[model samples]
Structure formats: C-alpha cells, structure tokens
Target: MTEPADIPSPERVLDAGALRALAHPLRVRMYDILSQFGPQTASSLAQLTGESSGATSYHLRALAKHDLIREVAGRGSARERWWERPRGSVSFTNPAVMKTPSGRAATQVIMSEFLNRRHQQLMRYVGDSIKTPEDLYDAAAVISSTTIRVTEEQARELAEQLTKVLSDASDRFRDQEGEGVVPFSLRVDLFPLPPESN
Candidate 1:
C-alpha cells in the first residue's frame, strides 16, 4: 500500500486523443484493476478479469500506448512482464472536453463505463448483505462525512485531508502481510456548483 504522492493542481482540460484512447470498456476496466492491484502480468490480469488472455494482452498494450499504464521491470522473468497505473487518479474539465464531437463521445464512453462498474459493485454489495437493522448499522459505522462551502483553495485543502486519511489507513494494514483482511475501496468526490443547480 504505497501512499499517493502530493495532489497536483487540477488540469483545466485533458486532450481529446488521450481520452479517446481510454474510451473502451476493456481499457477502463484494465486501468481500474491495475490501479487497485498494483503491478501484474497480463496472464494474471486475464485470470482475475475472466477475459481471454489474448484480449487482455491486447488491451494492456492499448492502455500502454496512451500512457495510462506502463510496464515495470520484473525480476528476471522474460515471459512475464508487469504493468502499473501511471497516476493515482485522473480528472478533467467536462465542459472543456465536450466541445468537440469526438471528445464528447470519448468523455461519455469513459464516464459511462466507470460509473456502470461502480453501480454494479454497489448493487452486488447490497444484494449480498444481510437486511437486518444491526447489519445495516454495522455498515453505516464504517462511513464518515463532512460538508463545507469553500473557495478553490479550501477545496484543495479538503482533497488533501481526504487523501491523507485514506493513505494513513492504508499504511496501518500494509505491513500485516497475509492477514486476510477484506480489501475495501475508498471513494472521494468533490463538486462545487451553485445552489440552484442542486
């Protein structure tokens, strides 16, 4: 569980070609899997994702082409190369990227694929969980929240705070190898908009 590095300034926009390269469902899935699991070989990823080895290998190459992921050196294994995510996370100005037809399509495809995967995971969790009051309460205890109205500077501060909290928790468990703790995901989202929009 390596800590994420310093949060950088938000890009006002992202390139159309790069986003287009990321638009495929398989590519986005590969990115998310690699980001969560760290470096892995294509064969390992294929088994984890339940996709054909050749298809996984192909999408891995495509993702590499767009600089979203990169091959990392492995220990003297010529048959098995490892890959990793380029960044901790990705962001872009939605409106700025949507001006061009291809850009808009690419944006829609990437977002839809990401959100659909999230929704499916949430649904699976809900479906498999016990419906009792005590069970729900236990689940609720794991969640936290805060609200604030802020300038851009404050928003950046909030982002840093959230990232630190998650990173610290990750550090705590990282050393306990083979403890068999269920891996949980941390999701952080920030939106600043006029009250009327809500």
Candidate 2:
C-alpha cells in the first residue's frame, strides 16, 4: 500500500519549539492582540496589555524568535518597535508535541489561554449584538452549535472540507484594504463529545 501524499495547507502547524515559546499567558495575549488589532508598537501593546513597555518588548522579541510575530518594516524606531502577527492560521495539533509531559503541558497552556480569549470575545459579541448596527450585525453575527455522529475518519474528512472552504474565502479577501474593512476572527470548533454517564 502506498502512503498518502502530504497535502499543503494554508495553516502553519506549530512545532514543539514554537509551542514552548508561545506557552506563556502574556505572550499568548500579546499575540492575540496583535492578530486582532493588526500592527502595533511596543508602547501601544503595553497600554493594551497593561504591561510595562520593557516587559512587552521582552516578550515581543521572544515571539519574534519563533517567527510567531515579526517587526513591521520601516515602522516605529529604536525605542519602539512595530510588531504584527503573520497571516494564516496557527495549528496546535502537533502529535509529536503531545508525546511528552512537558510538551503536553505547554500545549495545554496555549490552548487554555486561547480558549479564554475566545470566550471573552464571544461574550462581548453577545452583549453588543442587540445594539450593533443592523447591516454589520446581519452580515457577521453568527453563533451556532450542531451535534452529529460520525466515524473518526469521517470527522477528519469533514474538518478538512470545512477548512478548505474557509481558507479559500480568506485568501480571496485577505488583502482587502478600503473603507468598511475590519479585522474579524473566523473560528470553527469541531470535536467529538464524551459518552454520557448513566
């Protein structure tokens, strides 16, 4: 039997080193802020994160070391550096990283931090949904949950198909620069639930 060919993906998979570097709570928060708000200077991030400029600068350099974020070209100065999160999704589904206790712990930290941020975003959206502008709300607001039974392989297939759809749409509009353009997080969660206890 032949092995399946490795298919290219738009998402960047995080290795153990990158995962370890990003496992810190503050680093994760900074990365999320950069992603959500686009390029920012260390001073700006310091204000947003409520951390000192020195601290944010230190963490920013750490994130840059792993290529998770990069300094914006020709932006800011020696005292302040403009940093931005690179485009594309970051996947934390590295199997090898989960083989050891340390790797697993790091993975847990990153995942937990992201989940907390996402939950806060969801709650804020819900709170503002009623008062949000009709046009913007109608175009973007969606909160959905659906349950379906499927085999493991089938689940993987579904996820791949869904990912492709999102990737294509993202690529098409990724560079849109004009009025009404704004940063939006497109998130999808697909996983199996545990069996119910009697």
Candidate 3:
C-alpha cells in the first residue's frame, strides 16, 4: 500500500473484507488516534486505550493487513514499530459491496459508532463549556446543515470540490509549526435530500 510521492494524499475505498477487519471498536479508535496524532507506537496507543501493548500491536497488524493503516518507515526498530493512517482518507463508496449481508452489518456497526462518537464529542463540549477556557470555547465549533436540489452528477461534483478544498488546506498547513497551533476537526457530508412526502 505504498503510494507514490507525487500523488496527493491517497484515499482508500474499503471493500467488504476490509470493512469486516475494521469493525472492531478498538481498531476504529486506534485509527482515529493515529490520524489525529500522526504516527504512534503500539505502546503509545496502548497507553491511550488501556490495553496491553501486545493487544494493540495485534490490532495494528490487523489494520495493516487490510491496508487501512501501515507501518511508519524508519521511525522505530523491529522491537517497537510505529503505525499511521494511510494517506488522505477512507470511505465506504461502493453500494454493491455495502449491500451484502456482512458488508451491511459492518457498515451499520461502524456508522452507529461514528455517530455515537460525534454525539459524545458535542456533549463533552456542552458539559464542559463552563470549565473550558473562554477563548478556546468561543473558537470551538459549529454544526449546521442545509438542503438543496442536486442531480447525481451535481452531487458528485460538489463532493469532489469540497474534498479538494479540504485536502488543499490540510496539506498546506499540516507541518507548519507555529505557537498555539492545535489539531482541528472538520467533517463534511454531501448526499441527496430524501424525498419530501406526507
């Protein structure tokens, strides 16, 4: 799964087999940690997840076997290897695969966990708003949605444009170390508006 240096960040389209491998809770959480924090050793992730290093290492290997993540080269010795997310982002883009029995079950579990995590994050902000520093709190977040008309092609175009913009911004500023720079989270989803009927 090594990508060419000339390619911008690589996006993975996970099939049913890969999805099944990633359906575990710890694996999903480990993937998020690696993405947000950059490369990490299994020991480091284990410290974060309260699992033993051996357990986290096994999970990391499993994730690597499916190409959801990979070893970070030259960062660690054979005794302690480092791991990271593969390039840009990953998606479940194929509906034909997702419609299969195993694929549908895995998709449902992952999506439910994803939504649940988002809910927990929002709740943490509201619950801890009083304790959070005022400046950080003010700069924290916004969640909004809008419905619009769009055909399949138009929707695809919009998704492509949005991904390009986000990718550009991420690549430009990712390594610029400046004072007070902290990782920020962004999510954008584009899909057809469900039919309106009463």
Q: Give the per-residue Cα lDDT of candidate 2 at 66.
A: 97
Give the alpha carbon lDDT tens digit for every residue of 55-128 in model 2: 99999999999999998888788877789987777887688889989889999999999899989988877767
- Local lDDT at 31 for model 1: 79
Highest-lDDT candidate:
2
- Writing each residue's lDDT as its tens digit, candidate 3 over 1-198 gives 545544577666788878888888888788878877778999999999899999999999999998888888778999989898866667854587777888888877777766666677667866676576684458757667888888889998999999988887766655446799877667787877677999
* Candidate maximizing TM-score: 2
- Lowest summed-lDDT stretch of 10 residues in model 1? 3-12
Question: What lDDT score belongs to each candidate, Candidate 1 first?
Answer: 0.70, 0.84, 0.79
Clashes of each: 0, 0, 0
Each model's TM-score?
A: 0.68, 0.86, 0.79
Comparing 2 and 3 by lDDT, which wins? 2
Question: What lDDT tens digits, residue by residue, belong to model 1 across residues 1-198?
Answer: 233444332222456767887889888888777766667778988998899888888988887887777888443276777888754346633676788888888988888888788767766666656556566656733444467789999999888898777666545543344665555666666778657764
C-alpha-based local distance difference test score of model 3? 0.79
List the candidate numbers ranked by TM-score, top first. 2, 3, 1
Please identify which of the two predictions, 1 or 2, would achieve the higher lDDT against the true structure.
Answer: 2
